[model samples]
Target: MTDALQAMKALIEEINHHNYLYYTLDQPGIADADYDKLYDKLVAMERETGIVLPDSPTGRVGDQLLKGFDEHKHRARLWSLDKAQNHEDLTAWHTRAAKLVNDYNTRNPENPLPPLSFVVELKFDGLTLNLTYEHGRLVQAATRGNGVVGEGILAQVKTIKSVPLTIPYTDGVIEVQGEGIMNLSVLEAYNQTAAEPLKNARNAAAGALRNLNPKVTAERKLNAYFYNIGYTDGLTFADHREMVEFLRENRFRISPFVRYFDSIEEVAQELDAVVSMRNTFDFLIDGLVVKVSDMRTREALGYTDKFPRWAVAFKFEAEEAITTLQSVSWEVGRTGKITPVAKVEPVDIAGVTVQNCTLNNIGDIERKNLKHALGSQVYIRRSNDVIPEILGKVTEEQDGEEIVFPEQCPSCGSPLELKGAHLFCLNRLECRPQLIGRITHFASRDAMDIETFSIMTAEQLYQELGVRDPADLYGLTFDDLIKLERFGEKKANNLLAAFEKSKQCDLASFLFALGIPNTGKTTTKVLADHYRSLDKLMEATAEELVLLQDIGDIVADSIVSFFRDPVMQRSIERLLQAGVNPVSEEAPVIMNAENPFFGKTIVLTGTLSSMSRDEAAKKLEALGAKITGSVSKKTDIVVAGESAGSKLTKAQQLGIRIIDDEQELLQLLNG
Candidate 1:
């Protein structure tokens, strides 16, 4: 190799090692800033030299967009694993595997039992990708499109920070197979800002990897953990566990949850443990992949055309059931959009009796062709093991009649209009349901957090006290509340007190509480923080509003339209007249506080020793400190406690200050 080529190889090796440490091991030998500096230096060097190595990280970006996916035949056929749905199914699979191995050994006679052992690993909820490496450099990465042929995703895969551009093992050639998964935290954060949230992590990862922009794929933070060597030269292992350990040592991202078991019962127990701990993990896992540990036994058991006889995926049972749609009702949300809700005859799914499910919007009703007629048989499926959704009409016409969309708002009798598939109540102020929903939303924990006012109280105040909107909430009196059904003097006083306290909520929360269309808690906060006051945000033009990150035309228009409403404008004036100061024009500064994070953005990592994460966050917020979700350049302090993982390492690498306990934080706050 020439000097430039050798240097390029060294750079690739260094970057790949860092990638393995950060993404795979969840430990980093260097900080993110330092890593970025190194990466930038290498890129600049390649640019200046004008001699790019074939395996250089810069070579990953495709020069041109392809019209469609082109399939390349797989070197080795990728087969779908047979699945065991429940414990019984798992036991049956184990018994079958044992029997197959025992029968094979008996036939051989001289081979003996072959030492039966199994390797159990988490079945990641992601797209399977096959990566081929030549001379320790990743040459090709392809999606497992149809088991036989897959679209070449090498260019896209190279953008993934987790996938190493060069393999650690400097061998002849190796083909490693793994699943490309979008981290659950990343997906959740993405969805919070996404126009339409993805259904699950797997779909998000798959969609992100296929995007035209490599930068977009890079932003998704897609990760991969190699589970099997599809084909490798000059290496052999007696057991699957040993092979996984070998891969780990070689700086390959190996499956972390792999466990070895000696008996069928032991395997079942381990699988159960894995399932129980699923929620605690940061990535999505759909099932457990169990394979015979002994390579000799696996060979003896052999494989079928579609699956391995030695291995099976023990999948978690689908949380789904059939129920009768007893009634369908239209609920006017705070934003005046009508949502269809299905009241069903109770049916047990995943140990819970689900009697009600969200129909999302009118689009869902029409898509599912859900009839309002009572007694409609509907099949409900929990999408991704949570949030019940009506799949489709199970049995068409039951004893119930077909339901029709209401021509008028159910709460205010105002005529409704169909904006796209949604029924909108034009009476933004007078609509009783809308008013109640707005108040409830404003009082929600994510909003102003009026702890004492219940949704029922809001509704009652709207109906009984003739209150039309949130501002009218201030017009309420202790006497008026006491006269309501089930209201005592003490309850009435508490409700009034909460309403009074809510007036002091910051500008951002107040903006969020207004229930403007497309304005969520985060967006409202950004708008409020950016503008610093309600009047400034109200004066923002559509073009200006759209300039904010996560804000678009629809949201900007909604905001402008909200301020333009005569009733809403009058309500704002009334709130001002009633001494309801919504905005904190100036943030109070803690001067010379002992706390190290007086004016900095501090994030709590892992489980805190002194208090719950929420408690720590609350305490920090009380001390004029800004709390953020992730470790970025803006983060000034990271209070790491027990089990501090990625965030702690990232913070340390960034050279952000750290504190160990709440007392230290308190001192900072006081100082």
Candidate 2:
């Protein structure tokens, strides 16, 4: 070999070693910057010399031109997951699975339903691949092509860093099914510099895998999470969870979010929790995969040609829709920022009828040219499955009508000023729409937990009851509510009761209820816990607010803006005058040095056998435990009883540690 070729080989070896350490073993000998420098040097050398080794990392970008995929019949038919659209569908699927298991157990008492349990995993939004390993070495890999037959992609699959070239399972063949996913962060970073950005992570992965150069594929940093053992020899796992554990133990890249649940409710809770934290995860997950634990039970349940009866994917509602844009209307939010809303023909998206989609700001509208037509076909997608956004215009025809930016606010008719892309309404206190939205936000469950006051009710109360703001809500009487259209005595009474109940909320909740732009429940709680009173919090400056944990410039600015408002100040004063007491300062109990439950949040549900609820709470408090009435992300342990309700369900959903009895609690506390 030439000197340059020898040097290139050495550099490639070094790069591969570091890559294995960083990606596979989670241990890096050198810094990422240093590794990148080494990789760059190797690439430059290879380019200069025009000599490239076959097994070099640079050679793994694209797959070789295949004549065609070799037809290979699967040992067992790979069935798709039966999809559940919503919670009701999920419950129905669970019920059917349970009934099937019960029937199986009844018929064959001796060989019962092998301890029914479920392995819940995230259904990745990517291509699925089936990898077959013979005698611990990867032999073949194929796509899930029509379940029965698949194209061979073994040579290309070997390039994936996560796909192990060899496994620990000896003297047997095992087919592992998994998703080939592109990391969202990596895709975003690549898109930032690329001339054309990929639409999503799934599409990015698909494009990268089909690339002509294997080196390009390696550059994408694709990952795989093996979930199913399609065909295994000399390994008899009774349940899905066990099989997952086995795969994990054998150094296979398994889905980290996979969990075992005892009941269907647990599965539902898991699904909800996954949806809640979907944004936080690095990879894209479309839904939750729930499978019957027992292999025999699964076999008995059997499969249709398309989907398995025993397994179901609880899919979240679709966030994308194609619709005709009827017109565009600019609306001012609570912050006085003018958002151009596309008045589209009503389209069902994500389980809700979306008639209006936010154009974000003037810049967004102008860039997309959303306001050019009265009847334009448009594609819309929800960002993070929450906020509706217009992707782009589909049609090219515009009736030569120029789209103009609104000079005045839609609600208050106040003059608008352009602050960069956002048109700001100067009428803060007088804007009726802003006031209504603010009041509704304040009374929301995450803020003050005012159950009865919705947006419509707030609007009616504003116009009919002569209430301008949230403070005016306290002035409303049952008689006033009863007088409104469609409001009966019972509904009025309930609203009044809810309003009354909200008056005694904690200082944190009250702070959040102020509808400050960036202040959320957790931030409010932190501020309230630290300051302990609204008076102290109100006195705090922007700098002081920013000093708190997780408080950034945006949040600090919002807090300062809210407090600086004369109308908001008057509202707070009026609330105080109306006998709204927001003081709930519970001193944290200090525990002994030897206390077992130091730094743990525990929730008690149902009735305790050994101790009263209060007694149990007191004991936990004595051990330096912080007690919360509800189970949330904050709750660490849940002491469940015979019939624990939603709290228990939420606890399980959040993956909070649960203790069934007093003994388990004691063990956890001590440990």
Global lDDT of each candidate: 0.69, 0.69
The residue-level lDDT of candidate 1 at 565 comes to: 79
1-671: candidate 2 lDDT, tens digit per residue: 23454345444444554444433232333332233345445657755764443224453321112223465556545666656767887888878877888887898787576656787888887667888887788888876654666656676677788899988876556788998898889888888888877656765675565555667767777888889888653355667877888888778898878788888788788888888888788988877788888776776788653467888877665455678877777766555666665677886542245666555566666677665755777877642222355767777666424557888888888999876666778787789877886787788655677866667888888888878877788888887788899899998898888888888888877887776654545677788888887888888888898898867665677788878888779989998887788985674556666655777887777667776667778778867887755665556788886556566777778898888876877675555
Q: Pick the candidate with the highest TM-score.
A: 2
Cα lDDT tens digits for candidate 1, 100-199: 8778767777656566777888988777889888767888888775466677888889977777887667645567789899888988898898888765
Model 1 residue 274 distance off true place after TM-score fit, in angstroms: 7.2
- The segments of candidate 2 whose C-alpha lies over 4 angstroms from its true place after superposition are 1-240, 243-324, 344-356, 369-388, 394-400, 591-671
Residue 656, candidate 1: Cα error in Å is 12
lDDT of 1 at 91: 79
TM-scores for candidates 1 onward, in order: 0.46, 0.47
